[model samples]
Target: MLPLSYAIRNLLRSKSRLAQTVGGSALVVLLVMAAVAINQGMSRVLSASGSPNNVILLGTGSEESVQRSEVSENTTGIASASIPGIQEILGVRAVSGEIHFMNYISSDDGSRAQALIRGVSPAILHVHPEVRLTQGRFPAAGEVMVGRLAWRNLGLKQDRLKIGTSITLNDQTLRVVGRFAAPGTVMESEIWAAIGDIRVVAQRETISCVVIRLEDPEDFSEVDLFAKQRLDLELSALRESDYYGRLSEFFSPLRAMIWITVSLIALGAVFGGIHTLYAAFASRVREMGTLQAIGFGRTTLLLSLLQESTLACLTGTLLASTLAMLLLDGLTVPFSIGTFSIEINSTVALIGILSGLLLGIIGVIPPAIRCLKPALPTALRS
Candidate 1:
């Protein structure tokens, strides 16, 4: 069999063609890897936000978003009291009543986009411990706190979302008094306000949902059952983790759509890659014949060709993975997916690399088979 160096030299012999094939293949691989990574990252962010020790109370049929649920203040209080095994800290149960809304905002240029607005209380800080007041203080009644992703992505600076900055929400001006950060969850894309104040401003007499922390994670089912048994409250409870899991299910169709679309595109790229390999091999018919003319057998020629394709593909894979890491690492994109945050972790890189190599192997098979089929004389004539 020819040394691997021989295959390397052969690729270098046609530098332009090698560059084109590798570059094109790498671009395709990079896009696919990025989409997959984003999907995985979003799933991770959603999963991480859920805690088995916490239970979420929402109106029935409101599985994904608390905003869709409307539970009266009295109902929230009763449900909070009814849930067994709830932990009380500093005389207050580890529960937070919240409200949610979205509004369109304009930058200096008047470019507008939707921004998430959540109404939270002091308990928000406890319920979502991952949240931190990075550059400002916690919001008080009638004061709003913007998240880091919102600030970063929308260019809503501390001054823009800080104390005394007025933002129009539902035609009512509200003050921005604080800015917070929740590293990877959907919460990072939101601006928070005092729940009671938001309710007053939005004319909402009821809260969206209530989040409760339990004394023990194992008590979640019991608390859920307790809430369920109290039908007068018209409330249901789920572990915070399970709540987010169900929310993640809401985005599964979108994820599936991306996967299906990418799979079809990958199929086309694979065919293109096969065609390129076939052409590359066809050009080297005489070289294969020369090897066959010598002691080298058809199997050696086939193996060598496969090795070349594999090497090319592996190189493309490495290139794609490296680019994704460098470019998409820690990118905070707003997805409709649960807690939409894209994280390009090591797993994503590995999958990207493996996908490239697999595509390469599949692409080279037909071309490699052609070499084994043609006799030495026929290859020489071609």
Candidate 2:
């Protein structure tokens, strides 16, 4: 068998080719990590946002999107009175009727930006325990509480939405009272205001959805039955978690697009590496012939080729892991309704390393097989 040191020494023979393969491998791994990070980030946010014990009441035929759903002002009272397994907080049923609006908000500097606004009552805090104010007080009528990442969602600077800033909504000036955060959830990118205020400013007479927390998760059947009996309101019951999960599925095409685009670029890089490996192996045919003459098996040469290619790929993996950790780890990106942190954790790193090794094997095997298929005398003479 050829010594592993032979494979290592052969790589140093052409520093330029070594550098090219290493650099190209690193770029391909980096693209893969970026794509994985995006999909993982979106999934994390959606998964963290829901509780199985919670059920949403939306208008029938609008289960796909809450923004398009409309529940009547009397829906909340009817649900609280009719539902049997609703969670109660200090004698108050954990039922919240909210008005969800997406509209252009005029900032302090007179610039308009689109934002997701949720109009809620004081019971919101009781219903959604994940949301907590980090600064100042909760928003009241004529006031709005901006999410911590709302500025990014609005494409504006943080100072523009900070506490004490004034925003205009339909000619009405609303003051920023606080900033809240719901970590690992899309709630961190919304603005909360009083329901009456939203109704007055947005000029909408309808409630978007009713969010209800059940005492027992298994009580979803009761909620479903209630929705079915209420044919008058034309309402449907959906689990809160399932709603966000569906939203995640709706964005799946984006993840697919990312993979397709990055895979093509990585494929090009793999082809480039294959070319480099072919030339490097072709240049060493005389050496291979001499090794064969000295009683080394052809399999030894093939294994040595694998060893050399893997080392180059592993070097690139090291570089890519470092860059991903420094840049993508914990990096926050805004989405349609909220923001999520790109998580480059241990699993993602492991996947990236394995992908790099796979690329190396795929790029090297065909060229190695081709180079070793010649007659011994022909290889020696060439």
RMSD of each: 2.3, 1.2
* Residue-level lDDT tens digits of model 1 in 29-73: 887888888788778878877877888888887766777888777
The residue-level lDDT of candidate 1 at 113 comes to 60
> Candidate 2, residues 1-382: lDDT per residue as tens digits?
6787988887788999989988999999988988899899999899888889889999999999998898998899899999999999999999999998898999989888888999999777766888889999988889999899999888888899999999988788899999998888898999999999998876878899999999899999999999999999999999999999999999999889999999999989999999989888888888888888888888988888888898889889889999999988988899897899898988889889998899888988988887787889998998
lDDT (C-alpha) at residue 125 in model 2: 77
User: Which segments of candidate 1 are over 4 A away from where they belong?
Assistant: 105-111, 152-159, 162-164, 337-340
Q: What is the model-wide C-alpha lDDT for candidate 2?
A: 0.90
Candidate 2, poorest ten consecutive residues by summed lDDT: 122-131
What does candidate 1 score on TM? 0.92
